[model samples]
Target chain A: MDDVLRQGVEIRLTVNGRKHREVVEPRLLLADFLRQRLGLTGTHLGCEQGVCGSCTVVVDGETMRSCLLFAAQMDGSGVETIEGLADDPDRLHPVQQAFWDHHGLQCGFCTPGMVLTAKALLEENPEPSGAEIREALAGNICRCTGYVFIVDSVKAAAETMASNAPRGESP
Target chain B: MKPAAFAYCAPRTLEEAISLLDEHGYDAKLLAGGQSLVPLMNLRLARPTVLVDINRVDGLAFVESGDEVVRIGAMTRHHTVATSSEIRGASPLLSHAAGHIGYRAIRHRGTLGGSLAHADPASELPCVAVTQSATVRVTGSAGERTIRADELFLAEMTTTLAPDEIVTSVAIPRIRPDEGWGFREFVRKVGDFAVVMAAALLRVADGRVASARLGLGGAEGTPRRVTEAEQALVGSVLGAETIEKAARVAAEAVEPTSDIHGSADYRRRLVHAMTRRALQDALGRLEAGHG
Candidate 1:
């Protein structure tokens, strides 16, 4: 606890497969850390209360609300934000591609969280039914698409990922 | 929204975490999955000066079976509890109820211990724990002790746990082969907190209910068992008439508070409907010989 009261605490963690070490205040949320500190604003914060999943990101292979976590808490952990979904901008991740093909976004505010949640779901369940996809994406609310297109996108991504070779990337 | 500034410490062991709690006393709060507490903190509803993060605590996340009970470490995530085959076998009611909690991402980060310690009256885990009569294990600087699920909750979002104590694990009695259980909840949205929830477990012998346990949430300040309803089912044939009688008793027994979600009368009505449906589901499972 004494270390926390200091001006800053040193934290070492990996974001999108890249390692970084920095000194940050214990109260800095992971969402702000990514958006302000690291310049990855894709992780949008809709409701910092965790009701809206717009700030969702993968922490050690599980989806977590970045707004609900302190940057200090993620020390030594691997985090995957929406920015990490695709390697090359031209060629998007399978999930992102499916979202584009299916018109899964109108405002695009929730797309990043939606795509990451769908990616995690597909990794765990290669083939999920429409109901399962809706259930998985229930936390990530998309006010524009009405979730019909989002479900279609996730379904298509599941098929595309299953046909492709097992990627070396962690889900 | 952002939480107020707080000193944070991630202790790597249960003993170390307990000692930190002892030191901080009322000024400290335990950080588990950060699902409930974090949200409350971000909303400025709870402001603890110290956050003792127990996520890094060793040997706290596990689900193991004892001779006649299932021992689940306090830090066991809701995702694991929902999908674990072992837990499903030992306590299908718990597994079923866990699956209904929030959504996939919320479940992944939420923990059993945190849910119990938070003691949200509308939550599924607390209702299930009361129905199953589970025992929570808590540790402090003084020693360790177990509290029954029925006695653990004192009110909404409040538990009987001391400020210096941390819940370690929960032991739930295994549901026997002859016993059947059912859980039902009514929520406004897919992942919203339940408005009214009911769970029932029954053991039948000679076409009559030998033993029964019924619990309801969102109908009162704390999730509670309706012993009058349970008593009504014992030795009964569990027919529609008997089930209706028990449901009426459950509805009458609970004192629900009126809120924006629903009126007190509406909640009582929900309690009746939910109780009847839960009992029917339990009887169906028993008839199918799958309980």
Candidate 2:
């Protein structure tokens, strides 16, 4: 208790290939940190608890709920949000393109989390079956898509990422 | 909803964490994965004055194999437990129960100790631990001690752990060659808490049940090991009659309370059905010689 500060705490971390060192309130969630302070609003805030996957992001190469994490807890960690998925703004990431082509979203609130989750899945498993794909995204709730097209989108993205992969590399 | 403002400190070592806990006492809360605590804080259910973050504590996240048991660190994430080849081979029932905890995202951040400390009656890990006869290790200002899993849980969202103590790890016995394990839970949604769940560990030798351990969750106010059901299967050959009797005993042992998801009678029925299914599944695995 002696070491605690009731005011803002300074934290340094990497987000979307960029480094940020800022002072934030101890209660600030990583979701709000990204959306409000950094202006990366793609990580949607739904349910505000760990239940909804709308605020999902890649933290140290694993998908996690941003809403459950305090900004200060992410110090020195690498986080990849929805903004970091594609290099070029004109062209979408393969997963996003697959989602678009397959109509995987309707309200689109859960799309960012879904796309990032799919990327994590594909990175771990290059050629996942439909059941595996479904199991991986089971956390991401999509009220609109009914998950049929979301599954199709992830499968399509897997193929696209595999084909676009570097020579002799399976990932 | 937003959490109320609180002071935060990340301890770098277990000693420092324990000292902090001793200093702050009931005013402090440990932030492990934050999967459960942060949500409760957001809902204003638990608003501690200080948060002692244990994420930076070194040497607390590991899984080691001993000669007789598998030792899992407190900070080991659910995904690690679910994907660990060693844990899968030694305690497949624990791994299977970990998969039922939440979805992949939550699993990535949720820790084994956090779930056990939360001690929700409907949670999967506590029931699994009770069925496996695991031992929960804790450290405090007084010293380190181990408590049996069945003795750790007291009531809903409660444990025997003191406010100044932190759970350090859990040790699960390795499945013997003759042991067969099964875990089953029924959930309304993909990631919801189970309505009724059963975990069974059975050892059958020469067509007779050598030993049986049964744990039921979401059926009463506390996650419990059903000794009556275990006694029903211990001396009998796991025949249909024995399984039915154990299921009936399990159902009768629990005092379920009605909730929005199910009525008391409905959950009792589920307890009976799932007890039978879990027993049958374990026996099937035993016959297949799958450990």
Candidate 3:
């Protein structure tokens, strides 16, 4: 086997549409890799375990648990966390604005995951009912409020985003 | 915390995976989704010298169903079954059970094959597999062999899989459109494991039960079929009274033990109640021709 120091694997990852080629330790989790190496800390980590959805990020267009995967495993995948959502100066993603307006978060640790979840939900369904939004966010655990505001935020985001949506299917 | 020190081998092909497993024998572990094994390794419950990572291996994550059977890949994630339109139409019971497994993230990474291989008494898939007469496909240095569901599991966290044998897929009989199926369980939290779970699959023909299969989890070391209860339902019409009587017999077949979740007697009673409800739901679905 190669030397342990050479355990830093050469991996190519596309984050937020920009690709980065770097050598990283196999032990570096995708969550930590994004935060520490790639300087994208918008993805939060609440429970290191997969319980809290705080570490959610989209890999290859599918929402996944970043904490559950190693950096080496996602070498060739396209990843999009909250950092990749919007660069447009004129408009903010609806899920972002909904959280800001509806007071969906208190501690703010779960906001990143909440926003990603909302983004995923709205992308798949332009008009999600309240129950559907709640069910979509079941993986995200918020210890602050009883999830009333979170559900409301998702519902409002769905409505607001639907009004200004592009006619094409989700990419 | 990181898992204990172990050599990791990331094989890019199935042949390489088998070669590694064959060489390392019992000391090598297959890391597919790592949903269960990673946690167990982190807790030091399972310490192995080598980990043969198969996440990079291709073509093992899928499900294929024929007229009478559905073959699900070993590396197929739980969410795959839960959201599969084909599986929902073919075997709603499997989809329903997969939907109730943990949360979305957990479901995204956890594999049906992993759950069955782990063989936890409280898990949903094993119990459902036993009830539905699924078959497990295993590959090893000896090529491959299929083990019937009843012979696959022997004890808690145990299976008939040889140390060098890797489970490739599970084969389930395709349910007829009018066949009845149900799974019911109680959980303390959204993603928590079940306290006790029960599964029922009844084949009804001409307004009478043709055959029935029943199984329970968290009530024994391994998921067990309630032969006595099944006998009660086979020749009778699928009705409230008959369903209730079958449930009573199903409860009598269990020797549940008390845990922090519930007492033995309480669990037995819950099993009976859930069995009754599930049978009713199954029959209702069959009569309505719901897939």
Off by over 4 Å in 3: A1-6, A88-90, A167-171
Cα lDDT of candidate 3 equals 0.83
In order, the Cα lDDT scores of the candidates are 0.91, 0.91, 0.83
Tens-digit lDDT string for candidate 2 (B121-161):
89999999988889999998999999999899998888999
lDDT of 2 at B251: 96
Off by over 4 Å in 1: A1-6, A165-171
Q: Write the per-residue lDDT of candidate 1 for residues B1-291, one digit (tens) a residue.
A: 788888888888888888888898888999998899888998898988888999898988898987799999999999999999999999999999999989787888899999999999899999999999999999988899999999999999899999989999999999999998889999988889999999999999988899999999988989999999999999999889999999999999889988999999999999999999999999988988953
* Model 2 misplaced regions, further than 4 Å: A1-5, A166-171
Q: Can you write out model 1's per-residue Cα lDDT over A1-171, one digit (the tens) per residue?
A: 545554576899999999999988877899999999999999999999888799999999889889888998888999999999889999999999999999989999998889888898998899999998888888888888788989999999988988796777868
lDDT of 2 by residue, A14-116 (tens): 9999999999989999999999999999999999988779999999988999999999898899999999988998899999999999999999999999999
- Candidate 2: residue B202 Cα off by (Å): 0.7
**RMSD of each candidate relative to the true structure:** 2.9, 2.2, 2.9
- Superposed by TM-score, candidate 1 places the C-alpha of residue A60 at a distance from the truth, in angstroms, of 1.0
CAPRI category for model 1: medium
Judged by DockQ, which candidate is best? 2
